[model samples]
Target: MERRTKQREVIWRTIQQAGRPLGPQEVLKLAQQRLPNLGIATVYRTLKAFLEDRRIVVVEVPGHTPKYELADLKHHHHFVCRKCDRTFDVNDCPRGIKNMAPPGFVVEEHYVALKGICPDCRNHGAGD
Candidate 1:
């Protein structure tokens, strides 16, 4: 069993409080607000341990770095802001997605990611 540390608790809380998946850098920045001396290496280490323990899950979007989120969240998809490269959880899943596959293909699993300018970017004209 891995020993719990202040750094690990802060990092875990940061990810848990965030409504969406966050990358290592994002986790570091947010965690540092409470733990001013927190480092990226510690964030990475804690994340690794969390993953190994199944306390967290990795979120991978094509062309983007992997992010992490709590493992117990309900089933959902993701939305990536093209302009800012931010990711957010899309809580609702489209119905009949598995039926889109060909007749002979078995849809054992699926992932859906929508890429577009988020409200912040769109309002700021970043997409323009």
Candidate 2:
């Protein structure tokens, strides 16, 4: 049982509106526009509470910092732009991914992240 504070609300709403996973710094930066007094400590603490309550889930891309997004979002994958270092949500997933696993291995869960030049970066001539 946790009381929802203005900071928490702002943080949650910021993440919800971002439409993609955000790191702690991104959340704090966006939340501060609404609450100038928002602190990094408060952002981290509230994120912890949110995780404990299952209000948010973590998005992990190998070799990158973890990100956070709303828990109720539908299943999806992610793509990272190597040029801009930005991550984007990829709604489409390949079928029969579970069959790729080795024998005797029960595939319970999976996360897919593709790395390439995103459209924005490609448009900017940052990548091929």
| Candidate that scores best on TM-score | 1
Q: Note the Cα lDDT for every prediction shown.
A: 0.88, 0.86
- Model 2, span 1-128: residue lDDT tens: 24347778889899889988888998998998998877899999999999999999988888777889889999899987777666789999889999999999999888889888888787787334
User: Candidate 1: TM-score?
Assistant: 0.90
Q: Cα lDDT of model 2 overall? A: 0.86
Per-prediction TM-score, please? 0.90, 0.84
Indicate which candidate wins on lDDT: 1
Q: Per-residue lDDT for 62-81 in model 1, tens only?
A: 88889899999988999988
Give residue 54's error in model 1 in angstroms: 0.9
For model 1 the local lDDT of residue 96 reads 100
Model 1: CA > 4 A from native: 1-4, 126-128
By summed lDDT, the worst window of 10 consecutive residues in model 2 runs over 1-10
